[model samples]
Target: MNILLYTWLGSYTDDDIERHIRGMGINCRRIEDTQVCNGDRYHNDEFCRSFEKILEDADYDCVFTTNFLPLIARVCYKKDIPYIAWSYDSPPNLASLEEMDHPTNHIFFFSKDDVEDYRSQGLDTVWHMPLAVDTDKWDAIKTAGRDIDVSLVGRLYSSTLPVLMSRMSAEQQQFFKTLTDLQLKTYDRNILKEFITDGIAQEICRTYEADEDATLRPTRKQLLYSASTYVSHLDRLLLLRVLSKKFDTHLYSTDTEADYKSMLPNVKFHGPVSYEKGMPEVFKSSKVNLCPIFRENVSGIPLRILDVCGCGSFVLSSFCPEVAEYFREGKEAVMYRSAEEAFEKVEYYLKHGDERESIARGGYERVKADFSYDDRIRRMLTQAGVLKK
Candidate 1:
């Protein structure tokens, strides 16, 4: 099959996806169009015209992207070409779903909830495909002995919170505090929306100087999502802070120095690491890799867990429903429901080396057997009707 891998520059997943497609022995050509990629007006006439011209010139049987592109979907619909989009993020931008029902669009989402939601709306083309790991790259890294007791590699979401919170009054601050506590304690459901009414969200938006345009105003769902992310940031920081007090903890991220110095002074913070060179080594060397699911992703499993497992590292992840679906709970991987439980498990695993190594081996075997990039891409292509059994 001849495939055009449509991508945006600077996207972290595009390189991996392109590599996987070519590995499947398909003739793949990649085209990066910044205008259609980074632009805000994806549904505008100019974008459609530019994208249509590009699609017409590229001679390929199918077009595939890491995420949904509405303009591309529209052009493919008109040209009668299949457009396969595999989305990695959850709660996809509402605009992406507008052209979802187009005949030529085959959309895949990582979250089961998202797939069910679209299916309920009568879109049969949408499928739930969980994210997989590039075991080929990950397994090549030599397992140099475990150096760090526990490690986490990702964003802290510290950049936006202070600015947003600075505008609120004491009452609003207290209200948000209570809501975050509820979000931290609760699981599966987005409790922030149940507690934060539309009026309260508008008031908070006003304080933040949100634009007066109705389109720009934050909806209750958006506010709840923000609150949930804020809670996740705080929860992660708290977990690291307390875990550091008892055992060595390392944080690999681009978090600002001031935030770490003030909040988690004892925890070691390293600069961000790329997936190709640095992450596999970190995972291989860490005794425990922490996978704290963002609160906004109620049941979706983060890619970090899969990557860690693929590297043959012990992972203690925050509870997610999908985790149970993929791996056995205490045997292949460990799941923690709360911060206290996470810390307790970390201590137990650190002391019992045999048990930890056994679980890590189990996770690695499971991922290699069932969740490799090659397997995932083949299934995706088959679903898109680009590959035959």
Candidate 2:
């Protein structure tokens, strides 16, 4: 089967995905259009016209992308080709799902909650597929040694927090604080939504200077969820600060100028690393990879946890039911309910080298055996009816 792999800047998994697709004996050609792919001019007619021009010459069975691209979906629908999108982001903007009802679109989300919600809306092509890793690339990475005791490789979301909080009133701020406190303590289910009343949500939207016309903007629930994610970012910053005090914690992100940097002076901060080259080494060299999942992700496992496991490194991730559903908690991976619990596990696993290595081995084997990109893409193709089972 022939596939057109659409890619853009900051596509963490595209290279590995393209390699794995070719390894499966599929004819996969990759195309990069920075304009539309970066989301800067995604909806522009110029981008769509340019993209269509490229597609006109290439004969392919299907089009594939890492995330939902509406323009591509429209073009594929016109061409009578299936447009398959594997969404790795949690709670992908509701606008993207506007095309869920499109007959030629096959959209896969990492979050089961999202899939169920869309399915309930009568979008049968929407499926729940958890994120996967390229085990071969991760397994081949070699590091000098495990120098870092604990490491986190992700964004600080520093820009999102202040902007969100600035728009909230004092009452709204207090409500949000209370809600996030409860959410940080609770796991398995999202309790933040329970705390949101329509009145409170409306007030928040008003305070945030949102568009007066409800039809032109995101719903109050989406606004509230966005705020809660800011809270989750704060929680991550706090956890890193606390952990850095006691453990040799290392942070790798481009967000170094955030206010949290001043407080985390002792914490080791490294500039951003490319996914294909540098990220695997960070996982390999860290005694424990810390995965503080975004607060918005209720039950979905973050890709970081899977990537760390693929690197054969011990991962201590925040509580996510999906993690437990896929791997033995204490054997293949470790889960923590709170920041304190995460720190405690970090200390325990650091001292117990043999147990940590065993769990890492188990995680690596599990991912290699069942969660590789080759396996995931083949399944996606079959579901899209491009490949016969």
Clashing pairs in 2: none
| Candidate 2, superposed: residue stretches over 4 Å from native | 37-43, 94-96, 159-170, 196-200, 206-218
User: Model 1, poorest ten-residue lDDT window?
Assistant: 210-219
For candidate 2, the per-residue lDDT at 7 reads: 83
How do the residues 1-389 of candidate 2 rate in per-residue lDDT, one tens digit apiece? 89999985446778888998999999999987666654643356777777778788888899999888888887788778989999888877555355567789999998888787678878888898888988877767888989999998988774343455556667766777777777767766677665666676666666556534333223556655676677677777878987898999999999777565797876888888878768889999999998888877767777888899999999998888889899998899998887888888988999999999999999999888878787789899999999999
lDDT, model 1, position 319: 83
Candidate 1 per-residue C-alpha lDDT over 252-334 given as tens digits, one digit per residue, 9 for 90 to 100: 99985785768898888899998887988999999999998877675666788888998988999988888888899888999
Off by over 4 Å in 1: 159-175, 193-216
CA error at residue 134 for candidate 2, angstroms = 1.6
Q: Where's the lowest-lDDT run of ten residues in candidate 2?
A: 210-219
Q: What RMSD value applies to candidate 1?
A: 3.0
